[model samples]
Target chain A: MNHFFEDSVFFGVTLSFLSYGLGVLLKKKLKLGILNPLLVSIVITVIVLVVTDMDYEIYYNGAKYISYLLTPATVCLAIPLYEQFEILKKNVAAILAGILSGVLTSLSCILAMVLIFNMNHKQYVSLLPKSITTAIGMGVSEELGGYVAITTAIIIITGVFGNVIGEFVLYIFRIKEPVAKGIALGTASHAIGTAKAMELGEIEGALASLSIILSGIITVGFAPVFAQIH
Target chain B: MKYLRQFGIILFISFLGEIANYAIPLPIPASIYGIIILFLCLELKILPLSSVKETGKFLIEIMPVMFIPAAAGVLNVWGIIKPSVIEYIAVMVISTIAVMAVSGLVTQLVIRLTGHSGHQ
Candidate 1:
């Protein structure tokens, strides 16, 4: 079994697809917030390697190809942002302000954590991009000399947390406007929160999509500046 | 054939972004440069929506799966992360909620102040 997996050129890719597919199925069946497809996929993939005693390097040999798509996939994000452009135009100021505040809040919070917890610069930079999408966040983390893997995990955790409590937080704040709700979720949670936004209403969904792109850009520009703090 | 062309366009833009990243002194990543360029092209009607729409959707749909390899790297660094796990979780939870509340409230306030009605 080890030799077979070792020699197969496509073994890692095959396992990834199978695990991710299973994760999607489980999410559909279980309907649990903690059962995020990405989280499930990671768990399954990790378990498979550990149980099989397979080397992570060997698994990554085939898995690396899939990561090559990350850049193009991020570029494709522009399409959705473009599709939602008209809605963005209608309430530009409110959307921009909302996303800006969210980005600032994210930065300041990370800064405070660094000071309060006495986190090293590496840890500080890793968490700086925690609230953005995984693709962009990973890039920011790498550029700032932080652990990209830890940043990815942190990003997924943040998104999952946001998805779970996003609506509840909005309700507590008495934020009734569709635009405000969308901005809050997307700005705070990235794509995972956008999933919740999609459930609320069409306007909220569109606005959330827009906020994801805008907030990502804002974080990219600002993460470097904040990384300078520690 | 169509999907191939769409992918080619995205790849070309990404290549351009790579060049820009090397040229620009800022800390911005190539992917961001690609995003900005693609967005401008679409906004200026330089690239029609149909040119990249279908393939773009396909790529985005599968985005999460692409992160598996990177996320799995965490297993190797567990020792480094173990001690600070609690602090990491604390910062994430506190900041996430704070950001959600602040962003929502500020947007709500701004919309009201601007008299946009926000009803639409």
Candidate 2:
């Protein structure tokens, strides 16, 4: 059993796929709030790794191939952004200004939380880019000497949390504007929240796509300056 | 052959982005460079939208699966996360809501100011 997991080629796919399969099954079977396939898969993977006493490097060795797909996936965002170009052109100024504030708010909120909770600097840096996609968020965290794993965790949590609660917040605040809803979804949760925005309508989906990239670009540019702040 | 070619286009752009990262003076990442190049390609009519549209949608639809490994890596940092789990959740939830409110309000305000209806 121990040596079985040591093989990168076999371990990563076998375990990851098995866990993900189970996750999908559970999601279909159970209608619980915590039935997130990603979360379920991660929890199972962690448990299996811990139980087998297998090294993450071995697991990652195979899993990194899947992770590499993110590059093309990131590029794929251009299609929807392209589809939404007309709307983007019409509201370019509003979208840009909203994104500019969205990026700053995300950063400042992290800082404010750190100050209020007196959290450590390392964690602060790690959480700075939670509002964007993992690829850019990981880069921002690594550049600032933050722990990448921590950043990844915070990011997944933020995305899932926002995805779950976004509508309630919108309703409570009476935020009826589609542009507002789309911007909120993309800026706060990146792609996952954009997935929710898609269900709202085409314009919302397009706006969400536009906002994710805009927010990512803004975060990339804003991160260094933020890193230097504290 | 078709999807392969489309994927190839994106991969080639990614390759150029990797090269640009080192060559360019700016701090932008290769992925961003790729995104920018691709966006411009679409905008300038250099890369027709139809070629990549299918492959792009196919890739984006399954993007969630790619995040598994990255999120699974969190096991390594469990020690840090365990101590501040509550604080972490509090901060994340609060900040997420705050960012959403701020961005949404700002977008609506900006749209209204620009004489756009934003009625929907």
lDDT for each residue of candidate 2 in A152-196, tens digit (9 for 90 to 100): 889987876776677777787766778778888899998778766
- Candidate 2 lDDT, tens digit per residue, B38-79? 888999999899778888878776666676776678777778
- Which residue pairs come into collision in candidate 1? none
The alpha-carbon lDDT assigned to residue A162 of candidate 2 equals 74
Q: After the best TM-score superposition of candidate 1, give how far the Cα of residue A185 lies from its true spot, in angstroms.
A: 4.0
Q: How well does each candidate superpose onto the true structure, as a TM-score? A: 0.82, 0.84
Task: Quote the lDDT for A138 in model 1.
Answer: 87
Per-residue error (Å), model 2, residue A72? 0.7
Q: How much is A123 displaced in model 1, in angstroms?
A: 3.6
What's the distance in Å from true for residue A163, model 2?
3.5
* Per-residue alpha-carbon lDDT of candidate 1 for residues A1-230, written as tens digits (9 for 90 to 100): 86776677788888888898998899899987677677788889999999988899889988988988888877776776677667667778888888999999999998998799999999999999998887678889999999987898888778867876887899899999988998899899887677667667656766776777778889989989998878
* Residue B77, model 1, lDDT: 71
